[model samples]
Target: MSDELPDSIHLVLVERLPNHIAVVTLNRPEVRNAINPAITSELGHVVQALNADDVWVIVLTGAGDKAFCAGADLTTVGSGQLDDLWTDDAGFAGFVFAKRTKPWIAAVNGAALAGGLEMALACDMIVADERSTFGLPEVRVGLVAIAGGAFRLPRVIPPAIAFEMIATGQSIGAQRAFSLGLVNSVAPAGDSVTIALELATRIAGNAPIPVRESLAIARRTSDLTESELVRMSDEAWSRLSKTEDFAEGPRAFLEKRSPIWLGR
Candidate 1:
């Protein structure tokens, strides 16, 4: 069904100059973008394909304006179909639980709760719609969140707030999330994806190697011990010194011109 040209409802991938940005959308907007097993499996494949194609960045969102993603499809919850749908990567909802070498952005278009929020947390950055809301309602449903929600939530927001969200199932507004530093940006509803793409475009203009390396170092050193931080910083500095972009930066500055980064 998604065999047509660009802008398919299933998954849309586009190339913009020096960058390739893949947008994975939750196709089932009729059910508030609830994710089924097939969607999950396809998500894994899509991510793999994008990475293999050397895409510098990826932005994931839902197909409609009403919701980015509600959560796992309730219809498949008890059918044991959800388990089978997961790819070998164990990525709860595609790339959320998988290891990715590149940077990703979660353009949260609307209501992002439970698995949806988990998916956003998995991304390197999150930009949400002003009308969007976030929560973890698994406790209320008598089920634990299995999609990296528990582990990732605490890391994104204050520990107490994350715990409270999981325990009370309280949904927070987009402004509150942005204030907590959980969301990178809050755009007008229905404009979240546009703002995200704008941001991605800016990011894609820079050298790709540094972007990936910086993300890797930041994540690695986020909660490091003193010794580990020292080691990581030393190694990262040494590694960056070896890149061609490292030399191009200073030369460009001295020459009063824009850098022509080779991303080497």
Candidate 2:
């Protein structure tokens, strides 16, 4: 639970948990935790490790209280490192541009603008600190929100509001982001990562099979046609029916006991 990080890696930190929750920290406080090519590579490794069945949920955060990520590292970007910014696994600037089956939660500590906001959008949930601010400021810098923000923002919030935020490059407060359904929860500054970790732990306590399948269903359902949705629902129901947790739920329900989910 300490805020201290290792002396190396320059960008990311990974801490394992008891119930399969992994906390991935963006470690670059001196530069407000900017996302550079090195950081993206480190993040790719951390994310790959979290994709294992032994790790259910991953909470993404920053090293210090100043910022989750101030955005792309302009210094690095200008130095010609932007071309190879993403990881080799088609992960955009880390995991922002890739879709992994496992669930991820963004724990925004402070400013999360441009590519940083895009990173949060890639996650399944967002837990932001009260001092945190979000913006897609690419337009202001003569670029565009190419990293999922252009596609995901409108889907998450009202299109007009999403448009305003993206086009205007205006920052939204953490509470305001929550009101607009952009963030799951807003906590006091410095507590965002802790809250995300607790939530991740709760989710990790569930059966692994169902947790992943359920997340898949929810994420895919948003883009599914009526026919496809029905098919997916049936498939999920059938798959869960074969799981040991499926029977345990009902048995424990009748016996008034806490079901022990083996994550089969």
Q: What's each prediction's TM-score? A: 0.88, 0.91
Candidate 2 lDDT over residue span 1-264, tens digit each: 132333235567777777767778888899988888888877766665556436678888888888888878888778887766676554567688665768899999999988888898888999999999999998888887877888899999999999999889999999999999999999987899889988888887777678888888788766899798878878988999988888997898899987787876
Model 2 scores what on Cα lDDT? 0.82
Which residue pairs collide in model 2, if any?
A: none
lDDT of each: 0.78, 0.82
What does the lDDT read for residue 171 in candidate 2?
90
Report the error of model 2 at residue 262, Å. Answer: 1.6
| Candidate 2 Cα outliers beyond 4 Å, as residue runs | 1-10
Candidate 1 stretches with Cα past 4 Å from truth are 1-19
Best by lDDT: 2
lDDT of 1 by residue, 19-132 (tens): 556566777789877777777766776666666555677788887888888887778887867675455675676667677877888899888987888888888899999999
